[model samples]
Target: MKTDRRSVIIGSALAGVALFAGGTLSAIMDVADARADPSPEALAQAGPLGDVVLGSDQAPVTIVEYASLTCPHCAAFATETFPQLKEKYIDTGKVKFIFREMPFDDLALAAAMVARCVPKDKFIPMVEMLFEQQKQWANQNARQELFNIAKLSGMTQTQFDECLKNEEIAKGLIDTSQRATKEFGVDSTPTFFVNGKILKGNRPLADFEALIKEAAPT
Candidate 1:
């Protein structure tokens, strides 16, 4: 029987990624309304690795996004509407944005791991770069392609290798994903929780603007 290299690569890349430590995993599963809309506070709580947030914490509106790195819709939003959203809202201190990983596949998980390994300040830029060049690297050799991307942010080859093999980082991401799924009912990529209101999919800029306006207090 022939062995599938991709499977081996992904398996190796994601080894021990699914191990959720502590009682939080069980607590998340025990939530009475896994599908209920989460409170803004609950949604804003950072995962195991903590959150790399943008804008002021006291902003009038907070936008929490659960996205997969390899999801084209997520890529679209990252490369397209996010800039405008950042300039008009995030940068202006009207909206605080939080990006959470909810990877839907092994490749996305691998990409998320690499994104997490970058410097805190470089995280958003790395995410945007990965989304912009997603077509170029996502379907190619996982190690080489991801390493190429990782190097752009000053990560050495050794660092990249170590990142992929870091059980803690990988597990943190999986824990975050599970929490998003079970606690927040985030079933799709690019699901935005705008002030605790669930808004799914890659909507137009106008739609986001409208939602932000509605969420903003008078």
Candidate 2:
């Protein structure tokens, strides 16, 4: 198998740093070479083209989130921090929020597919359900976990199976996600772009509050 390009470059840079400290020429050369290389397909899978729009197209602040359903950090953010932000900013018309799927594993991809099955109006709620039950679906050994979650979301078994088997939808999702990663340089889950400023990781409510305050209308 071909080694992932990003990993190779990253490993080379780290080894150079450790093995040649004193600002050596060889280390500098390695760093330069790594810089010339592009990231791998995995890193390039951030989102789709035209998927992100700044500010409600009207709101002062736009929050675009690239997240994985099975990621514990993402679940924590959704369950703990998002509600406050939604109430204080999104609901108040001060901010517009867009969620893009970033699948970290097969389970996460499955969850993303199920979330997309719901109508656009129920998209956020279905997303919340997936995050809220991440543990149940993520930990279960059976593939039926996805089906079970789908049923809870009002999908019959046949519908769930058909949706899961819909290769076109899956490919479209993957393509969109890839476009997002390539365009936005998204390397990790739960990455947020608030008014185009990147915020990585599962941050506390205070951080969001500060950004919202900064972006709030005068």
Candidate 3:
């Protein structure tokens, strides 16, 4: 808790620190290691990637999801289908879930990056909030909406902007989605890879259950 609180203070300072002149460069350097394509030296100092995993890693089923923060169908799945799936399979140690970003627009990418800026453990909850409130945000006032959502995790407006402005993270998201498109033919939101079988769009709970049952390790 102490560490997280301190991080909020430091992270908020990052937005305005560039105006300080004396500490601006040093502040940038401090988070430089967090850049997506950092050198090995920087990688050594890098923070958590916020790629949260649920259930045991050794679970029989592995579900990898590629979704966008601003996608309505993705939110539908999160709000409706996912809970049932999580309750029946994921929470029972039968499935290991991994979420990957596939942001389709500037606003989606910004939301994704803001989700990444928080403490790693808070990543999934932040994602849930964004998805649950997808209709409320994803507007002309998206930046403000995103800030309101991000503040639940202790992010200030300046920190929220700073997180979105990090090109490395933004580029990394683009690169990831592009790779998914070229290699895996992923061009939409709520694409799921259930033990290698690709299921696209918002699938109902029954569809996911059947898919999981078929793909789940015996």
Best candidate, lDDT: 1
How does each model score on lDDT?
Answer: 0.76, 0.61, 0.66
Q: Which stretches of candidate 3 lie over 4 Å from their true place?
A: 1-50
Q: RMSD in angstroms, candidate 1?
A: 7.2
Error of 2 at 95 (Å): 0.5
* Candidate that beats the other on TM-score, 2 or 3, i.e. the better one: 3
lDDT-based ranking: 1, 3, 2
Model 2, span 64-164: residue lDDT tens: 78787777989999999999888877777788777777664445666676677766666677788878887887785435766676676678877766665
Which 10-residue window of candidate 1 scores lowest in summed lDDT?
A: 19-28
lDDT of 3 by residue, 82-200 (tens): 99989988999998887888765545666778888888888989999998888887765665677888899998877876775676676566656555554555656788877666677
Candidate 1 vs candidate 3: the TM-score winner is 1
**Candidate 3 CA-lDDT value:** 0.66
TM-score, ranked from best to worst: 1, 3, 2
- Give the TM-score comparing model 1 with the true structure, all chains together: 0.84
Q: Give the TM-score of candidate 3.
A: 0.75
| Displacement of the residue 118 alpha carbon in candidate 3, Å | 1.2
Candidate 1 residue-wise lDDT, 1-218, digit = tens: 11122111122224423311111111122222346668987887899999879999889999999888878988898888999999989999999998888766666777888898999888988998999999887875656787888898999988887776797887788788778776776667788988988888888788888888898745
